[model samples]
Target: MTDSTATRATKPFRFGVVAPLTTDLPTWRDRVRRIAGSGYSTLLMPDVPKWQPAPAPTLAAAAGLADLRVGTWVYASPLRPAWSTAWEAHSLSVLTDGRFEMGIGTGRPGIEDELRELGLPVTRPGERLAQVRETVTRLRELDGPDLHTPVVMAVRGPKARALAAEFADTVTFALMPGDDRAEMTRLVRDFRTDRDVELSQHVAVVGDSVAPFMASPDTDPAALRAADSLAVLPDDPAAAAEEIQRRREEIGFSYFVFGADFAEKLAPVVAELAGH
Candidate 1:
């Protein structure tokens, strides 16, 4: 399908895998090399605590592999001071030769307890937006020559989405609860038409072996197929390609990210669809 005029052809199509931050060094090192060799565009790390490893070092390790870009899927903003993240992200940018993109967010729900345990302040929407803006400012000021880090705003709310559109290098319309493929597609179109920023999407890639474990509660294979084009399926390469190309045409989505477990499963699809 031909892209809408609103979609800029200058934006490139790319693919990424969201790796767990908590993974051991050796496993992560091996997986990152595998991801790069498999033709994925980038190897990403999630900011969630469950991912046990730290994002900065993991991203650095993956950067060591030849020609692989690194980034965060999304980082919880209220968990750390804006200056801290800004400093660390620039450090990452330097370490990775400007291949780092900071994915900042308002933060996940159910994080208050963790914040209190760490004696950190739990910020509201207004404050979090302020932090996003300030953090971006600090990153630009601190970065070395020709080393400006790209910012990926993980839009979780209206204000957050607006912030991303106005300020971020790219805006990701995450697939949240109650979101189906159609809604995601519509949002992608709207964002593309309304903003000049690049677009990204977050979804799971499900192969036959991984589908069961990756399925959401009460979601079956038929349900997933019925829901939307969110999960990239092994059996439906044509459908996957169609959905991917459709989004690319409409929204100029150069970045597609999936969880690490399913990243390998998506290699062939990436091989077929990337950069087209």
Candidate 2:
């Protein structure tokens, strides 16, 4: 391992919860407060349109209700123009008093179909990556020299990883339900060989329950365990904390993001490990 990767485990640990507004305003505010009170560092909203409210306004509301940071689980680049996305991100950063982290990516799987449905151009992979780049560039320009809004990038392919290495403050290796753990470790190791950015992993399952929208509803916990998937965590707080530390030591992952449904389940682990 390179020197940077070797020392990666020494990075402080922080936790985030991905939550969308699925209830009344009061209920959502309560959830946001509870998440902050539970020792979470950030509250994130997914970029899915129609199925949920827009991420910007929701995140603004969330940030207002709690002292915790706020961000997008990831903004899909193809959803809107780069300037528009960057403008909203810059506004959020300013409104939140620099507490907003911009999480962005080309888009999720099958984004082509979504684009087609919305009558937006269905660009190729390279074009989508360009969009991400443009959005980040525009965001930087808008933020000016006085402020730097942190960027969190969720990446999967080599090209995306390269772009993330260039611009991301935090990087998340987008994992599928059954992706090989060894390969992921190698990828992360390679990514960290020269840079010391914070590494985040999205936890889809805590114990036997899979968080909604994180994975298929029928996703089998036994199957994931048998495959040694990194997307699942133990239910017991002590066990979960142990595994999280092991992951940081072995794979250089120090930041963990959990879906809202199981954020409470992992709060104990968060309470024990956050800021450590």
Candidate 3:
């Protein structure tokens, strides 16, 4: 058997879709099929309130349709018990036959409101990250038929990134080429002792006009500073397609996760890269 470490290190180049939770299943399925047909192999469904489906049931509903791998973009670590999340993820892995990848992070902003609405307590982030670590460790210990998935950590800060390298199969971040990008990569590499751990990266793309539409002159300097190599491409679909492809290659992520609306436009771009 290939060592788990080697297997992770050697996983193939992947293209994945980030399915927003609120999208209808029929729409999502159609998208997934198109994505699979377009040569992408993975799907990253976000676990936020509006994005989350009934995990196992939703996954089951989409099961066996295409040659695609699927997993959570992230589940809110601070909101639920480590044991509960661990078991839930494990069960999903079993149901999906090892196609699941777990992305976890400290709860996001406004989580308090969401939890209260769902009748849950709102806790602090540091405590939740710690709890999540313990739960992930325990889940990693399970073997045999109960096991099939790999847990990943999505972190931005240095300390959390280091911790993820030590425990998770993959350590990922929302990276756009900037001081933070260089710093994040450096931290991950410095702390990552094993060749086995995978580094997953995220990048956002927008047409050249997007700079005007999405970014304001007063947007936080820290956020803007974080997006250094962030490109401003032409508004035309073809030009946007080319620009997205270029950005993906420049970023060097193991997977390229395209937004839903960009799927059709990104098809030729993805094909161009694959051919290379």
Candidate 4:
């Protein structure tokens, strides 16, 4: 199916910045305010433990300081009990006055090692998917009837996609570097065949710089450009805007996320295309 046939083409464009707080409190507050002032719709935090502050408290702080939405650029489901995760997500939704989105997934690649390191159970893929489902289910129960917290799911395999179809308000593909653009197109088309959930693309690199935790430190921009990876975007504002429009038109990707490092540089593109 072509983009014209896809349901997400009608969705307005929006951008999100995945910025982990790596600075002092005052500096971080300034960065959050700056991102809000820019045209980005959401301020997202990574879920990696020990790398930065916890997502909940930090996200709450960001929400207090900015007018934009806040979210976990995805919570790793295997780290905590489903109820605990759900309760935290629901609290964020309430604390942010419904401006919080719960972006979650089974976990990143090789998360089992991390779980083992943390002394958490290393669950199988199916079990991890079950954990994700339970978390969403309990979150809905906690949210009650009046509040429906938005769910953004990062999916890779068929099972995860099926689960996402059942519960997600937004879905982002868990794509790796050098993955084929055509394959991603097919996935988006297939997922949107009978569903109109929002489609999000996680951009790892803008120009020559790779965002922290988004990709390997040694990631080569030249190689990504040569391979035409979707994880990278052109640095020039016009070129980036053009590529973003093309992605939305052809692959049904209307929500683009970038690392916080390039949020300022990409603000112009956000200004030109956001909510359009």
Models 1 onward score TM values of 0.84, 0.96, 0.74, 0.96
Residues 1-276, model 3: lDDT tens digits: 222333343344455566554567688788778887887656666666544565545655555667667777677786678888888777777777787777788755557888888887677767767877877876776535556477778776656765676777776664433445455435434444444665554434444222211123343444443454332334465765565554434433455555556567666666656434
lDDT of each: 0.71, 0.89, 0.60, 0.90
Please state the error at residue 74 of candidate 2 in Å. 0.4
- With a 3 Å backbone cut-off (N, CA, C), the pairs that clash in candidate 1 are 21-53, 22-51, 22-52, 22-53
Ranking by lDDT: 4, 2, 1, 3
- What is the lDDT, from 0 to 100, of the residue 30 in candidate 2? 89
Off by over 4 Å in 3: 1-12, 21-24, 50-52, 144-148, 175-191, 208-252, 274-276
Candidate 2 global CA lDDT score:
0.89
Error of 3 at 205 (Å): 2.9
Local error of candidate 4 at residue 51 (angstroms): 0.4
TM-score, candidate 4, is 0.96
**Predictions: Cα RMSD each:** 3.7, 1.6, 5.5, 1.9
Better of 1 and 3 by TM-score: 1
lDDT of 4 by residue, 156-272 (tens): 888898888888999999987767788778776667335568889999989988999788788888888888889889989899999999998888789999998998899999999
Model 2 scores a TM of 0.96
